[model samples]
Target: MSTELLAVRPDRSLTDGEAALLLELLPPERRERLLWQAEQREPLCAYGLLLLALRRRLGWRSLPPVARGPAGKPFFPDFPEVHWNLSHTAGAVLAGVSDRPLGVDIERFRPVTPRLLRRLGADSAEEALGRWVRLEALAKQSGTGVIAVLNRGLTAAEEASAHDLTVFPGCAAAVVLGEGEAPGQVRIWTLEALLEGLAENF
Candidate 1:
């Protein structure tokens, strides 16, 4: 039952294994988004699949369409009662769903370039960016795009006063799931496990 982290490919499109799994779960239009760029497409599609699967697992009829806020945070329209987050990095994307406000992040284990760091932000600024990442991730989880909620003034940092922010430095993606309650627990699973489960069900 041990789950090791799986890497996603940015350049490659979704694999047949992934595509087929998605096909079985997603409607035709939803499945079309899986083409191109693992960096963006794969994770987003996977997130959609996960949401659908979770709805089925929980016995919900359907989830609200993904929507974004002013600062580029994703949210659920139908299930305004639930909070969620989504994040994608070099090779992987992570998503978290909960009844409380939550944020999840993953960063690939790589050195931060001085130039990128300089432009991105400094200590507090970096923290703010991190917060922004969580916020944006939340928007994605809600099924909304980041641009709708992308903005400034949000602070980052693991210890920030923010509710439930989960950071996964290993893969390089951050997510924030915010709703009625802050998360009291979290479950971490490898992308491979999700894919395997998807494949088996398909």
Candidate 2:
């Protein structure tokens, strides 16, 4: 079964021209939503990275229509068999696709306290964040999110099943695969390079 994960920390901000060109490659819905998300002033758009993942993994130039699950997880209704997920922090964006179900998340390095670690049932800050991301990825996969996961929590095997995705430095990411699935190596991208690639595709 095929599995793909991607991470991109945009090396630089998009120029006006670059942004305009990128809009042309996106589906109409994404263009408007990306614009809405841009208002948050995040370094990169998760949707853009999501588009890159789809193109690179499945050779699809644009997304079909999507619908959200009960928990607000987005999926392609016409392509239910194709499992995919996306996430982003101010510093990085993550995307994944696989033959089996999958979910992913990304976060930049930050200070964490012992108190916070205790809440996550971890002994150290790094372990806490790692556990945090694993919990999030597992939550995303299960469609109930963190709150629910916190209520019932992970088993030893469930926590063990979450794999770190090697992307850019100074970020934490994890992906959870369904039964019998294994993770693929991650591919990192720069926004400038991605823009150039999109231009070539046009």
lDDT of all the models against the reference?
Answer: 0.49, 0.75
Candidate 2 local distance difference test against the native: 0.75
TM-scores, each model vs. reference? 0.55, 0.87
Worst 10 residues of 2 by lDDT: 38-47
- CA RMSD per model (angstroms): 6.5, 2.3
Q: Which run of 10 residues does model 1 get worst, by summed lDDT?
A: 1-10
lDDT of 2 by residue, 124-167 (tens): 66677777888899999888779789779788778777898777
* Candidate 1 lDDT tens digits, 36-133: 44444556544644554465446543344666566555566666656655556665555555555555555545555565456455444445455455
Residue 125 displacement (Å), model 1: 13
Give candidate 1's error at residue 196 in angstroms.
Answer: 3.8
